[model samples]
Structure formats: structure tokens, C-alpha cells
Target: MKLWDYDAFILDLDGTLIDSGKYHAQAFADAVLAQSGYRLKPYEHHEFFGKHSIWFAEDLNERYGLSLDPQEVLKHKRERVQEIFVAELFAGAQAFLEFWCGKKTMALATNSPLEFVEPALRDAQIFNCFDVITTASDVKRRKPDPEIIEITAERLDVEPEHTLVFEDQLIGIKAARAAGAKVIAVDNGQPVNYPVDVAVHTWNDLLKLSELHRWNPN
Candidate 1:
């Protein structure tokens, strides 16, 4: 009865697998202000969490009428982030990955570019858990487009329907579901008016697998 029906897993990097949201939020605010002369309020940055860095730049550019390049904006943020980035695994992130590693084929999909994603995963000591990893540069599109997840599934040689994705943001949940994968989300203290196959307040809920089998992610 405790058996679940997922064949593969995809982990989201930022708030889902690691506790980098706080650092990322501050760095985003700093980078945007330094580049665009527009400062994002706390509410705005909180809403911006887990989004593609390039998307953030594009949104900011459109909103502020700035001519900042998305790639440059992302690069600036990465510099700030890399200076202070330390991987703090979210609750049960390690245990969850450890529990699922051998049981399921897995990969990581993120909108973050390699400059940021690689170091975070390494610092968390969970880098080896993934069989493959994909970032924004790896695909033509990022989250909310489904391309990244689909690409990850392709690289893993797994069907989308068999891939179960864990995410922290609605954008990622939307992307996973659009790519035909079931999604489990971490609360990250954010609002989730959207639906996922499962949503848990902490990774501790991931440790409670009866919860997963109860939902039957099919």
C-alpha cells in the first residue's frame, strides 16, 4: 500500500531543494536596483521568487522601461549570489533525495543558469544524486513554458508521464504539469492558489511517503 507510482524525479534548485531564497531575493533586489534604477519592494521580490532570472530581467525591463539586457542582469545577480551563495538544504531535502536516489531515476531542472545552479547543488552535497541536470542555457525556453522539464525528461530517457517533479513555485508546478509530469511542491511560505499533485509544508512531508502513495501521483 505504501508503494507509489512514479518512475523518475526532477528536483528544482532554489527554494525547493535548497534554502537559497533569502539570499537570492536580496541579491535580486540589489541587482535590479543597481542596474535598472528600480527597486523591487519585498512583496514584489517574494512574488518573483523561483522565476527564471532572465524572465525577471525581462519583466523588470518592461515594467521600468529600462534597456537592461536580460543576460547581463542575470550575470550581475549571479556575481552577487556567487559571492554569498551557500547551500542550505531545505527541510528534508537531503533525506528526501537520499531516500529516492536509488529508488527512482532522477535529474534536476532549473531556470537558473549554470553559474548559480552548479555551485548550490555542490555545496548542498546533493549534486551526485541527479543523473542529469538542465538549466536555462540548456533549452530554448524556461519554466512556464514546459520546455525545460520536457528536455530534462528527454535527457533522462523517461516519459513525461513517469516523471515526478518537486517544485517550490507555481511557475515550476505549472511547467511540470504542462510537460506531463506530476508535481509535488514545497510550501516555501508562499501562496499556492494553483494546484499540484501534492503540496507539503516541508520536505518532512516528503519523508512521509505514505502521503505520496496516498495521492497516487498518476
Candidate 2:
């Protein structure tokens, strides 16, 4: 297949650029268990992988009658994630990003709070790759809201139509598309039922694409 060209880039943090999904998933499971004695199903891990912590908590509460306090659930999840999570970038993510750094102006737009994001990327040694960073704390809205993506584009001074986004979660994909950017769905063992421009299993798969498609001047 051919590439969809673009001038700027946006990436999702947890699953798209890093290998932190399992840790996050486990953290959610542990948090739920601790809060209400409920065990999250294996599929629940990725069901809301890219959403804000509060949203996940609300979903759990609404669906299971757990009455989980969003803040409390977030606290539990964060504590567990911090204690047991190993900060690691996905294989080839750093290499692929380094390759693209020379070619594109990239930004990070994740639902993760600023505190978690900065340290995670710093520890993973990929924090400096982005020209702009927009986390949950930076905006009033979260994924599927388009605020974060829109802000990232503005910070990069790139037009939304000229931007391309890498996302692994359906929520991220929805937000990227809502921001009017092309979406490349990164498969991180999660199922995305959205209509994205392209889907790949790893950053290397994109690196191997024949070419990245560029904007057409009419």
C-alpha cells in the first residue's frame, strides 16, 4: 500500500509510542479490585486504554454499580502503576521516531496527566522528540473531545488538515479524526472498530511503508 502524506504529526502516548499498556491495564484491574472487590475482565484493559482515568472510573461505576469515586480510582491506579510499572518504549518506537524527527514536526497528545507523561517520556528517553506536548491537565477536555489534538496542532503551527496522527485506541482515533487529521491506528493488541486511514502493528511497520503520503496542493 501507499502512504497518506502529511506535514505534521501527533502521537498517543500509552499504547502508540510506549509499551505501558500492560502495566496500565494491570493498574486498572488492581484499582478496581481494591476499590470494590471487582476483577476487571481481560478485555476491559484495552476497552478504554486511551481515555482519562475519571472516564474509566465512571464507566466502571455506571456499568457495575460500584460507585467508584473518580479521584479515588485514579489514585489507586496511579499508585499501582507507579509502584510496578517499568517505563519502557515499545520496540522500534524510539528508532522510528528518531527517523521521523528529521522529517516531521511531531507532538504528543495523550489523556495521561502531565505529571505521568513528563516522567514516563523522560525515563523512556523519548521526551524530547516532540515539538509540543498536550496532556490531560493541559486541556479542559480529553480524548474523543478534539481539544487536545486541536491544541497540539496550534502549538505546532500546523493546519489540522496537514497533520497526521498515530493512535492506538478508538477514543484517540475519534479525537484525531474530529480534529480533521489523518489517523494511523497502531495495533497494541487492542481492537479498534473505527474507520482509520491505516492500521499497523508497530512503529517499524510504518517505517517500512513505501512512503508517507503528503498533502496535495490544488
Candidate 3:
């Protein structure tokens, strides 16, 4: 199928449309350090992508053998994220979204909580682009569980098999696949090694590819 052949488009927030992964990682690192006095190893933050803060905190506890409260770490990380995070959309992300605004059924699905997701979308000025928005708070389980993606597809009133998910992390891709959606790995410098139906380095590449498919939004 062509890039624009899908009935709906589901996009992951961090690392996919926005470049906030570093901020998220830093916030998590700070939270872990403040709570457990253990610094996260370099690139350890990448492992936490596409997961809820509580899940990440629990994982930290298990990995480091620390008796840290997941709730406390989650709270601290949220506060740090609010103070430090600055939404910066990936190149051509706004354009791609704008181009498909009224042309396709779209949803923003992320493991990030609504507290973080809302402001980021608003800051990026693409909050209104999606027909539906699904966040961690909206589901009992996050990415890699398929609940988030499933719910997003349902909310968009589209079948998972007819939806196309754009993700950066393997967990999100796994969830999308599990939900029965085709996956497009959006590489933001760090390339995804997982198998996907399509892979593009940036939103610009996707835009060009879509144009080549001759699928007009009109």
C-alpha cells in the first residue's frame, strides 16, 4: 500500500512529531537521582521511552535494587518535566499535520500522560490537528501493551488494520503492530532497528513520499 493509502494516521508524541525526548530523559534522570541517589547510565533514558512515569520508576527500582516509591518519582519527574520541557516540533511535522488536517482521520496517541501531552501539543500549535487524542491517563496500560493504540484507533472510529501508526521507539511500534496497525518508523537521528512497513528519517521525507503516491487530501 502507498504511504497515504491508510484511512487514519496515528502519531506518537515524543521523538516522532516533537523533539522532547532529551528533556523527558533528563527529567527522568533527575527524578531518579533525587529519589534514589543513583544516576541513570548514559542512554538508559532511551529504554524508558514509550512508557508511563510510574512504570519507568518501578523499572528503575527493579534495575537498581532501590526502595524508591514509584509515586514519588513520578511526581518529581512530572514537576521537572513541566519546568524544563519546551516543545519543538520536528522538521515538516507541522506541515505534514496541516496537510492532512481535514484530509484524514488522525489521532495523537502517546504513553505520556495528559498533563504532559496537552501542553506540548498546545505549545507545538498542533493540538487541533488530531481528531482524537489518547494519552497514558486515558488507558490502564501504555505502549507495548497495545491498549493505548487500540483505544486511539477506536476513538478515531477507524479499524486498526486501516490505520497507519508513526512511531520512533520500538515499544510504540510493538504496540501499534499488536493493535493490528501498520507501522512507520520515524527516525529522529537514532534509527529504529525494528522491522516496519515503512521508515522515514523525517516528516519531510514522509511528505515527499506521500506526494509521490499521488494521494491528494482534496
Candidate 4:
């Protein structure tokens, strides 16, 4: 559990590092309702949680008998979500990060596209904190696929086994675990069904672990 034992660190956005899932759900629901007069229910929001917006849009189109292009719908949804993000970070995320500055190499690996990531983190004033930042737009496959995690490890020159991931979504946890990293699952957003190495309900949980694990060297 030691920070120094890990070669690289990975984190998920939306839910893990930020409390923006509700905004995302609202945006998606609004977009679909406006475009096709279809309402995405709460269960549907849960189902779409960790996926790429394009896939979510396509799924909605197929489910509702609509002919909207996935890309166009996704673009609209993103614009709406951005309006809701508005220079915010998860409660306690920035202060927690301050304690670990320069202690480990960090990366942000999310299924969100670069368009959203760039603005969100920058607006939150944490764009420079990570050593690497990647999104679904940069990868051939998204979460539940190990390609992004593998690429992240490779780029950071970090062994997959020594990497630690802070993920919010079950699919993201699966993807990071599949890449051979140990994971800490954050529960600030919607709940999930994945088994995690550790479950953290708040930044305090992470901070507590950091103090206990810092000098242990794994």
C-alpha cells in the first residue's frame, strides 16, 4: 500500500475524483428528452455510468427507435455537461492531492473524451498535477478493455503490478485490474458491483490509508 512502491497512479474522473455524475445524468436525460422525447430513467443512468457518451447515445437511439447520429448526440450532451461542471473538483479532492504532490507519478485514465477532461480539470485548477492524461478518444478501446491501462503503464515506464488506481466505476476497476494494477475504488458517486482491493467512501479514507501505508513499501 506504500506510495513509493507503486510506479504509477491512475485515477478516474466523473465520480471517483469529482462529484459530477448527477450533472452528467441530467445532461444525458435532457439531451435525449429534447432530441427524441425519450426520458432516461435513473436505472438507465446507472447502466450508462462508466461508458463513453457516444456508446450511450447509440444505445439510446437503438432502444428508442431514433435515427440520431451517435456522435452528434454525444456532442450535444457534452456541451450540456460542461455547463454543469463549471470549475469544480470533488469535495476534498484538491486538498487530498496536495498531500501527495511529488510523491508519486500520477495519471488520469478516463472513458470521458478529451474535450470534457481538458476543460474540467483545467477549470478545477488541477490540470498540471498529473504526469499523464488519457481518454477514450485517444485509445482504440474504452474501459472493460485493458488497452488504456496498458498504454498508461507503458508511457509512464511503470510496471503494471506496481501501479495503483483510484477508480469510481466497476468497469473501470475491471479494466485497471485486468492491466495488473491494484485498485482503490471510490464511492462518491453511484454504487457499483465490482470487487475492489479497497473501498473508500471519502478523501479521509484515502488520507488515512496513505499515512498507514506510506513507509511500508508495499
Candidate 5:
């Protein structure tokens, strides 16, 4: 399907629109180390990038046999994120969102909590572009569970089948698929083996496509 064919667009926050992956990873790493004395390897941080902090904590508990409380870990991670996280949007992300803000229904669906998401959106100056914003605090489950995406679509009054999700991680892709939305894998140089309707290296590519479609009705 063409990019404009979807009734709504749902975007993931961290890696998809903003370049906040490393900062989030640092917060998680710091939390895990302080709580359980187990420092996460750099590569291991990527494995939990798009999910909730509780998932990361629980997985670490199971994998390393640590009895750390998920809530406590999450709290520490949030604290660290608040202290060190700086919001930075990927190139062309703001322009792309601006281009389609009014022409199409848009929503921000992310596994990150409101505290993390709000500042990032405001910093990027695209907070008003979304018709709805669904974060981790809004759902019982995060990405890979479909609850977040499902809630976002419901809030937008759009059908999952008619929505297109732009994601940078496997868990987000899985969630979008489970929610019955078409997927556009944001290629951030990470290898994605899963199937998607399309893949682009940056939002600049989509911006160009939107311009093309706008200028050419046929």
C-alpha cells in the first residue's frame, strides 16, 4: 500500500523518532548495576531497547538469578533518565511529522513512560503533531504485547488495519503486527529479519515520499 493510504500513523518514540537509545540504555545499565551489581554489556542493552523497564528488570532477574524488585529497578531507571536524558530528534523527523500533521491522523505510541515521553516530544517541538499520545503508563503491557498500540488506535478512533506503525525495534514491530497494523521498519542500521510493508533509513525518505504524493495526485 502507498504511504498515504493508511488512515492513521502511529510512531514509536525512542529509536524511531528520537535518538534516545544510548541514554535509555545508560539509565538501564546504571539501574541494574546499582540494584543487582550486574552491569549490562553494551550489546545486551540493545536487546531490551523498545520494551518497558519492568521487562528488563524481570528478565535480568530470571537470567542472572537476581532477586531485584522490578518496581525498584524501574524507579531508579526513571530517576537516572530524568537526570541524564537529553532529547534529540533524528534528522528529518520533525519535518516529516510537520508535513503530515494535519493531513493525516497521527499518534505517538511508545513503551516509555509519560515522564520520558513528554519532555522528548516537547524538546523535539512535535508534541502537538499527535492526535493521541499513549505511553507505558497508559497500558497494562508494553510493546510486543500489542496493548499499547491497541490503546493508541482506540484513542485515535482508527482501525488497527487502517493504521500504519513506524518502528525501529523488533518488539514494536511484533506489537504492531499483533494489533493488525501495517509496519514500516525504521532502518537504524540494525538488522531486522521480520517482515514489514516498507523500510527506510530515515524520516527524510518518508518526507520526500509525502512531497511526491502531494504534488502528484495520480
Candidate 6:
């Protein structure tokens, strides 16, 4: 059965729900280069997205041969990201939210920090669509680790098997699967090595499911 058959939906924040993943990557790259005097390749950016920002900072320090404080570095990167997000909405993001609101018990689950998620969602006018909002800050571990997904399911009061997780990265897909939930991958140009039950090219695909009989997300 398709995921929309579930009682509730959980959406990933970055590339899955918003078109601003690249903006995030660029902001990080800009922060890294400005602080470390090195450039991050596109592939490297893909590798870092959908994970915690501190890890990105630590990775940058190690990769670029800099001896910087990871927390401080992450703070700088997050500041830049917040600035960029304030002015732009991820492409088709609003449409997806409009399609899913109240149709299902929906919420947002992301590896992004609350500072970043809250401001961005507010700016995008989607701060309230989510019945539950979870971030890496609230969890001990990030995606590829099932803690967040499992925690969200518990908070939403839904069985894991009955929850549908929408994610853009393979790591996140793995997390949802490990949590015993069905996952639909959103291909925001990043490739997934493992199998995903559904791979959508655009948020429009979620909207298209409105026509499917099995997809009564409500």
C-alpha cells in the first residue's frame, strides 16, 4: 500500500518540504570558506546536508586542516543560513503544505536545529501546519539514527508501521525504515543508494496522490 494510506504524515524540512536545500548548502559553503579559506565542492555539500550542522563544522575543520572550534563554526554557518532562508521559500513548499494540512496528522522532523527550523518555518508561513515539530536539538542523535523518528511516532501517538515519513536523503530514509515506518524519498537531485518505496521528483507528486483511492492521508 502507498504511504498516504497511513493515518499521519511526517515531512522532512530541507529538500523534501522546501526548495531551499541548495541555499542551505551555499550558506554553509560560504561560511566554511570565509572562516577556513577553502571551498566545499557540490558533492561535499550533498554529503553534509540532512545532518547536524555541528558535524558539518567538525568535518570542515578536519577536511580543510583548520583547528577551529566546531560549535563556534556551526554558529557562524547557522547565522548565514537563517539570513538566506528569511528571503526565500523552498520551491513548491507552500503547495505541499496546503495539500497536506489537516488531511493527516502532520508534523515536521528534521536534523536542523530549532533556531533554524522555527525562523524558516515562520518566514515560509508554515510554522503552525505541523502538529508536532522535532529537531536534532531535541534528540540525542540525528538521522541514520532512529531515535528522532521513533520519538516523533510516540509523540504523535501513532504506530510506527502506520506512519509515513517523507525524506530527501538516504540517511533519513534509513532512519525511518529502522524505526519500522514506511518512507517515501523525495529526490531533490541527491541520489539514494538504497531502495526507497517511492521516489518523487517534485512536491507535486504528493499533491497528485490526492487522486489515488488508497491515499486518504486524512
**lDDT winner:** 5
Displacement of the residue 88 alpha carbon in candidate 4, Å: 2.9
What is the per-residue lDDT of model 2 for residues 141-184, given as tens digits with 9 covering 90 to 100? 88888999999999998898789888888788889889988888
Candidate 3 regions exceeding 4 Å error are 196-201, 215-218
- State the C-alpha lDDT per candidate: 0.79, 0.81, 0.85, 0.78, 0.86, 0.77
Q: Write the per-residue lDDT of candidate 5 for residues 1-218, one digit (tens) a residue.
A: 88889999999998889988878889988988998899898777877675677877898889989988889888898899889988888888888988898899999998888888988899888899989999988988777899998899999888999999999988998899999998888876555565634465568888889899988967
Query: After superposition, which runs of candidate 5 have C-alpha atoms over 4 Å from their true positions?
Result: 196-201
Q: By descending lDDT, how would the candidates be arranged?
A: 5, 3, 2, 1, 4, 6
Which of candidates 2 and 6 is the stronger one according to TM-score? 2
Location of the lowest summed lDDT over 10 successive residues in candidate 3 = 191-200
Best by TM-score: 5
Full-model lDDT, candidate 1: 0.79
Candidate 2 local lDDT, residue 138: 92
Pitting candidate 5 against candidate 6, the one with the higher lDDT is 5
Q: Which residue pairs collide in model 4, if any?
A: none
TM-score of each candidate? Answer: 0.86, 0.87, 0.90, 0.87, 0.91, 0.85
For candidate 6, which ten residues in a row score worst on lDDT?
209-218
Better of 5 and 6 by TM-score: 5
The per-residue C-alpha lDDT of model 6 at residue 198 equals 54
The sequence of per-residue lDDT tens digits that candidate 4 reaches over residues 122-176 is: 8788888899998888899888898889888888888888898888887888898
Clashing pairs in model 6, backbone N/Cα/C closer than 3 A: 19-90, 103-218
What ranges in model 6 sit over 4 Å off?
60-64, 87-91, 191-198, 214-218
Could you arrange the candidates by TM-score from highest to lowest? 5, 3, 2, 4, 1, 6
Model 1 Cα lDDT, one tens digit per residue, 179-214:
988787776666556563355557886677634664
| Model 2 regions more than 4 Å off | 1-5, 196-201, 210-218
